[model samples]
Target chain A: MIGTWTLFQRESRRFLRVKMQTIVAPALTAILYLIVFRYAMGDRQVPGLDVDYFSFLIPGLMMMAMLQNAFANTSSSMIVGKIMNVHVFLLMSPISAAEAVFAFLAAAVLRALVVGSVLLLVLLPFSDLSLAHIWMILFYGVCGSLIMGSLGLIGGMWSKTFDDMAMVNNFIIMPLTFLSGVFYSVSQLPPFWQAINAWNPFFYLIDGFRHGFIATGDSDPLQAMGAVAILTILAVLSAWYLWRIGWKLKE
Target chain B: MNALEINNLYKVYGNGNVALQDVSLLVPEGSFFALLGPNGAGKSTLINILADTVNASSGSVSLLGHDLFHERAWCKRRMGVVPQEIAFDPFFSPREVLKFSRGMYGQKADDAWVDELLERLELTQHAHKITRQLSGGMRRRLLVAQALVHRPKLVILDEPTAGVDVELRKRLWDFMRELNAAGTTILLTTHYLEEAEELCDQVAIIDQGKLITSRPMKELIREVASSSLCLRYAEPLQLSDEDKSILSAFSPRVYDNQLCLTLNKQDSRSDFDTVYQAAKQRFGTPVDVSIRQEDLEDVFLRLTGDSS
Candidate 1:
């Protein structure tokens, strides 16, 4: 337990030491999205939803920031450690593979929550959004971060270099987050696109998160919750399995 | 009890490279043991397996009687590894590195002990400096300090002095000798045969993934029964036919006015007297003469056949 906590603390300090890149940059990116999209859309109402476009977009943008930063936190750390050969420090220690997985997950989740809170606080005065259900907001924020963090761990473990990590972020993570209805509701898209969005796990994360703020979303709340739960479980289990097998970590 | 023991250890990589081939050895408690081998001879592979950085394909390892695979955590808590390559979080200070390492081993941070290590390694002034900014020798010292932070009973140093300067290497050996005197079992893998001969009590040599020899340092040195005699003359003297015939039997060679003769260890004294008499009668007494006995280098070269 002490080893796990020490690893978590060290990993957290690693990112927090570079707040400009890990926290502030993502927060600034979120705010920029809010300003640019709000002005372009001009107070229009989201189709089939009572809230205005900006209000609905706020939750999506916040969740997106959380998810992206969470993923970046773990993936960047892992890739850098691998490149620098610093992973030997952890490998030579008494920490178990399971403990190492948990430490990385905890650090990623912490960074995500920190970025999410900063984005929310920075955008609160500008937007007329209210937390309709605080518990739902907490649930979606944590579960959504967990999903991305776990993906980041898997990607980090599998990648051999910075370029490989970037490929995963650009091709896989970026496409999923953008097409998951962050800028526009899935209901506004064609039936074929909506069907595709229904299968994306990011869609549930965004829909569930937006449901927390506006009390309404494009998907069924219960089904979205189930999807989030299942994806989170699968992601966690896969990361743990990879860690235990020492894939790309040990020789 | 032995500090370390291995049985039929084998490591076959994914590409089918056999790094360790049924290697086994034992290091007695409180011994300064040396693992000497040529490059690609599986020295690093064996060290990595013990450090838990690499897994073995088949076999077993035990550290102080604890199974390395099954009781890994327990064994790890009692061992420290200083790897060949310098590995540290660049952003972290030396103090933080030590603190974090102590914590990783489930040991509470002891500022006094850490300070003592820093002082002993001559790193007190650079304790708070970012590791990336430290000089190479400083970084190497920090690596040593990090390994000793948890006070492990057994310490493994893999090429600890590979790139260090003479002064720093001497200091490191001094520190290591002190630690060994305090009862820490030290396991070292080095390419420097002189270092092993100077410091280690037990020596093991591996070649082509096989343990070629494992014995006490003196005993191993004694196995090679050859010595050399080097005689330097004050002036260059042309060898007479009689001198040539007398020296040719011992394979004597002349370089820079010095005649070198290789002799069997048992006949070295008599051979020296014979060579001295012949040289004196021919050259009217040389300027200086010295006898060089067979050291670890001769034994190592003979066993591994790696003269280069």
Candidate 2:
């Protein structure tokens, strides 16, 4: 447990040491997103959410920040350490596989929450968000962070170059984030697009998390929570298994 | 008890490159051992395996009487590794790095120990500086400090002085000697044969991923029974056929008006004496003459076929 905490400490310290890239940059980007969307689509309401566009958009954007930051935290750290060979400390440490995986995920979740909080704080005055259901908000935020952080770790292990990491960011994570009803409501989409969104697990993450803020969601909150919970365990377990087997990490 | 014992260790990388091949070694407790090898001879691979950075394809490594593969956590807590590469995290200061390493090694935080390590390694002045602000030698010293932070029973140092200066090297060795005297087993790999000859009592040579020889330092040096006579003059010696014939017996080579002649085999006293008289007769009153006994460098080159 001490080992895990130490690793977690190092991870958070690493991110905190570079606040510009890890925290401030994401916060700035979120603020910019709000400004641009609010001006471009002034005073609009979602087709079915019946909520002001900014109010509906705030929680979704927070979830986006949560997911992206969580993913970026672990992926960037892993890839940089692997490339620079400083990960020798990690490999040579006595920390167990579970401990290592949990540390990375824990730090990721911590960063995600931090970035999400900053977004919420900055965007609060602009929207009429209820900020309801605090339990659901914390639950979905943590779940999303864990899942994205796990993916990031796995991707980092699989990547050999920054370009490879970018491929994941550009082709997969970006597409998923933008297409997951983050800026608009899923009910407004056509049947085919809705079906496609149903397949994207990210949509469930955003819907469940947004429902926490406004009690408005396209899917059953209970079902989405269950799916996210299972995915979180599976993702974290996959990370642990990789570390245990020394997959592209040890040798 | 042996500090570390490996039996039939073999590692074939994922790309089918064999890094280690049936290599076995024993490092007795409190012994200063050297694992000498040329480049690409699997020295780093072996050390990495012990450090748990590289997994052995097949082998059993007993570290501090614990099975490394079965009780890795136990082994890791008792061993520290100084790898060949110079890698440090840019985010952390030297002090944080040491604290983090101690924690990673399953040791409680000890500021006194950390302070002692910093002062010993001459890194106290740079403890709060970010890693990027440190010089190469300073970074290397920090690596040494990090490896020693946990005060492990066995420490593996892989070419720790590769780029360090003469002064730091001296200080580093003194610190290492102190650790060794305190009963900490040390496993070292170095290209500097003279340093190895001076420090290590047990020597092992690996070439082309196979152990060529492992022996006591004295015994290994004794096996290469050879000597060289070096002759120098104010003017280069112009050798005729007769001079060539007499000097050829010693396999002479000239460099900057100096003649270095080697007697390949040293066991025969009469042979050396006869050649000495012949060379003396051929080159009369040379400016200076000196003989050097064969050392570890000669033994290493000869046994490894001088492949490096």
User: Largest DockQ belongs to which candidate?
Assistant: 2
**What does candidate 1's lDDT look like per residue over A71-154, in tens digits?**
988888888888878888788899987898889889988998898888888888988998988888888888888878888988
After superposition, candidate 1 runs with Cα above 4 Å error: B228-262, B265-291
Model 2 C-alpha lDDT per residue in residues B265-292, reported as the tens digit of each score: 5454535556666667877757888776
Model 2: docking quality category: medium
Worst lDDT run of 10 residues, candidate 1 chain B, spans B260-269
lDDT of 1 by residue, B27-128 (tens): 998999999988999999999999988999999988899899999899999999998898778879999999999999998889999999999888899999
What's the lDDT for all of these models?
0.86, 0.88
**Candidate 2 on A1-251: residue-level lDDT in tens?**
77898899999998988999888898898889888998988998788766888888889988998999999999999999988788888988899998999899999999999999888888888767897788999999999999999999999998989999999999999899888999988898999998888989999999889989998778888878888899999999999899789888877
Model 2 stretches astray by more than 4 angstroms: B228-270, B273-291
Q: Candidate 2's error at B190, in angstroms?
A: 0.5
Q: In model 1, how large is the Cα lDDT of residue B186? A: 99
- Candidate 1, residue A241: the lDDT equals 89
